[model samples]
Target: MQSNKTQQGGVLGVFPHYHWRATEQEVDMAMPAPAPRPLRLNAEPQNLVIDLRRTAIVVIDMQNDFCAPGGWVDHIGGNFAADRAAIEPLQALLPALREAQVPVVWVNWGNRPDLANMPPNQIHLYKNSGSGTGLGDPLPDGRGNVLEKGSWAAAIVDELAPLPGDILVDKHRISGFWDTPLDSILRNLGVKTILFAGCNTDQCVLHSLTDANFLGYGCVMLEDCCATSSPDFCTQATIWNVKKCFGFVTDSTTLLAALQAPPA
Candidate 1:
């Protein structure tokens, strides 16, 4: 008997099962899976062991319109300063995650210029009185159109600008998964566990995490990495609902320590 080894061409997709390598004569679909980078972290409800190879950090609505002064939240008289709490922790956490090769996904409210895709209800969420600066409307400060795509209002905050390889998903609704390519992008990247962090913890972050849970992704809410201008009770309820219903809750401190700890 003679032994034959298959030699194939370039690899295809991110994950092993979805990837294929083809030569002029043959195609090899048996690419080996990447080594798992597992990190055990202390979390509420229970501890979690996540594979960095299959995990992504989803930072939701950490945009200028929500977090910075002279932006939408500030214009609407919301305490934008409160939302800034997540900024420092995320500043320290994201770079570390990127260093560990974990994907960073930013899901922010970047609306269509004409607001054509936005439903009346969605627009009403921001502009309840039906008259005032809302989605796509020019800000009184002349900074840019409110949350319009390609505007400063829609950009991530200066302190946390996304790196070249980071993924950005424009979301019109509270749930980033709705009517967006977010789920598809995660699926293509072979992401099974999502570490959620961003502003308005009781609203956008919580809703997005819930949607990810519904779609069967493992969700972990990084407590200190999420902030909201809402009242303190709101944060408590959001965290409770997350641990009781949607997913586990953890903080950046625990995660960062786990990431930096010597590999076992």
Candidate 2:
């Protein structure tokens, strides 16, 4: 009889070319997870798991200056509609987040009364941008003033009023952490995860989220509750960068659902 190898014939059509064999270099899909880093560098392995106990919702720059009609964004001839649209979603989300016992923080642009700590560059931007009330200048139509620390424009919008226990942080710069008590407050509260929602997605919201991520906080962006007066592409780019690099991107509904779900 002929040897088996000598008698073998191959078929033209075959479902599998060959049986798979594990090589020494082959990856082990079932390998145990490696130890997490001492600090969270990036928001990879996106998990919607939110611990309401250790989490806080940061409402960034939802002030009248950015969100309301007679504010700075509108002062510079920018359309405030997008910023206005964020209000209802925030209103819907705030109550649930508060009831769930998640801390709420309002971070808004509240410059010094005498413009002492205000950066010259920032002041320049506000001055040359449009023909409206400048920072610390009274609104022409009497809607308080713009960018004065305790003025109506610097306050959180009336619609999303801060409740009794909510944290209020006044920031001089776009990033709330700069020259403000925001970081210390979050640290003191033992907060590890930050849920970011507010107006001007490409500016204040983006800046604050970036700083939070840099400071090692796990960031979850509430997509629907953030907006910008810039072109729609800016908002798109901000969300894209957030999901791709800084943090997890989710909307109010998904976040509410996550918060409502019982822990595993």
Q: State which candidate has the highest TM-score.
A: 1
1-264 per-residue lDDT for model 1 (tens digits): 000123233655544424677777778877675778789999999998999888999999998999898998899898999999999999899889999888899999888888899889988888899998888888885789999989898899999998887889989899999999999988877789999999889999999999999999999999999999989999999999999999999999999999999998
Note each model's CA RMSD in angstroms.
Answer: 5.0, 19.2
Residue 158 CA displacement from its true place in model 1, Å: 0.4
Candidates' lDDT values, in order? 0.89, 0.75
Off by over 4 Å in 2: 1-45, 129-132, 262-264
Clashes per candidate, residues 3 or more apart or on different chains: 0, 1
Evaluated with lDDT, which candidate comes out highest? 1
lDDT of 2: 0.75
TM, every model: 0.93, 0.79
| Displacement of the residue 2 alpha carbon in candidate 2, Å | 86
| Model 2 agreement with the true structure over 15-121: per-residue lDDT tens digits | 11111223456633332322221222123236555455567899988888877777877776778777877889899999987886677999888877788877668
**TM-score between candidate 2 and the true structure:** 0.79
For model 1, the stretches where C-alpha displacement exceeds 4 angstroms are: 1-9, 14-18
Model 1 residue 247 CA deviation in Å: 0.9
